[model samples]
Target: MSAAWSAGCVRARSMLSRRVGAGGARELASRASLEEVLQQLAAGPYQRGIRPGQSLEDAQRAVAATVLWHLRVLAGWLPREGAESVRALAGWFEVANVVEQVQQPGTPPYLLGSLAVSWPRLARAASPEQMREELAASPWGDPGGSDPRTIAVGVQFAWAVRVAERVPRAQDWAAGGAALLFARERFLAEQPLAEPAVRRAAVLLGADAVGSASFADLRARLRGDARWVLSDVDGPGELWRAEVRWWDRVARDALKLLRTTGFGPDVVVGCAVLLGVDARKVRAALEISARGGRPLEAFDVLA
Candidate 1:
């Protein structure tokens, strides 16, 4: 890992440690409740009813907003440097405008076509042999010796479409149908992946794009926390698939935003406010992170 990435991770650890505090990593390890949170999110109305031409725009905005909000919180979240980093990463808001123009029940076709375009560019880093092996893998992980990045994204598109396919039908759903469904699957499974794996998985699943960061900073910050055990991040893994060139972009943008002048905690607060989380809980988590970089009752705050 580069020094910058390491520093960023260290900062993340420092901030996270303060929030979780005193054996808090274990709490987070077991806390993957999304149903209650989803239910709550669903109970609330969408910012506005979707108009005939607004579905895609709404999806774009919602996804972008959600990512920006979470990242913002994590950025300015105390432990000054970590807070700053989160703030810095918020710059690439343009990424969020991706699918803002498609129609309803929209996750499948719209996102599929997007993958066709995005996947190729993303897989440019993979090697020839790695690409060949990947294509021989899952429903979409295959590269066909075509463009590995494209193939990678195609798999992500498939995963998301599959996840969206599983959505529970209900009145008053807030986010897009696919996000809700995929999130539901993740929560129901309560599958806890290592932070990096989850980060990469989320990218593959098309949440936000990812870039690898240096682990040194994170290592230093994580020194005090047991739950920050990085077993999952280290692996006898796919060499090509292990890290990405752009993951750092996510972190950098977050950092830049945090360093901007005149933006108070409210930006972060307003961002979080939009998340459907109890403001008090997020605040408490931030407060804890600020104090000692511990993990908050992040898992328990939902629902």
Candidate 2:
């Protein structure tokens, strides 16, 4: 590895030690209340963003914000190429900003600083047409059209494509996620895939498979790693489990990458993915705690 990547990899691995692992998240889930959860997290890496009295939505956003901040710090240690890869993964934050901008104008953005893709330009957009124009001019590219719902789906697909292009190892994960996005729209939401969405899915899943009428049809049509994401998902009610399984798959794949790869972009990406898994686990735990449910029940799908 180059000296810069070597240094960045070292930093990435070191950051992994800061995560509240599965065990810690389970413990947090066992807490009696959100206050207890926050009190326990007060001394951790997430302490800055998560605080007492924040609503569940605010706390979830805080978890994401904390993860983004780590990505920003990690990017600073990387070379230009390595930093670009991290930046591509960080596009989720930009997508979130765009979604919020389309859904609710003037809500404060996630504060991405230098890691931003198009938030600076997107923030200034006063209407959907302006938003589409700005996105077309930026790296995110048009998001297909200005319709808020279509734009949301389009940006997500764009983010997946960008990540797959920059981080080749993440191609399967990106495609799997895109597959799930289509599945959710088709099954859980009971909505037909929008024309733009179908067109985007065709890029990764092929035109023949994108029009599958049922989960079984879609699963049979898929011939790549993306198919496994829906392995045992029978219907809409179990879709939540499919999502949980997706994260489980991500966590497993990331761990394997960390264990098998030397100090390189794969290791950096692996570290980032693992951190994301931990953040999601923590968020789930907080939700359970806030609802006064059994602590371990928060992860029932994993069982």
Best model number under TM-score: 2
- Model 2 lDDT at residue 74: 96
What do the candidate models score in CA lDDT, each in turn?
Answer: 0.31, 0.83
Kindly give the stretch of ten consecutive residues in candidate 1 with the minimal lDDT sum: 168-177
Which runs in model 1 stand beyond 4 Å of their true positions?
A: 1-35, 43-107, 111-150, 153-249, 261-303
Question: Model 2, range 1-303, lDDT digits (tens) per residue?
Answer: 789889999999999987889888888887778888887787797997988888888887898889999999999999998888888988999999999998988777888887888788789998888888898888777667787887788789888878878888888888888888888878778766556567767777767678788877887787486788888888767778778788878889999888956678788889889888888888888887888747475455542
Give TM per candidate: 0.22, 0.93
Each candidate structure's count of clashing pairs: 54, 0
Candidate 1 CA-lDDT value = 0.31
Total clashes for model 1: 54
Note the residue pairs that clash in candidate 2.
none
Write model 1 residue lDDT over 98-150, tens digit each, in one string. Answer: 21111111222222221232333323323545543543453334423334333
Q: In model 2, which range of ten residues has the least summed lDDT? A: 294-303
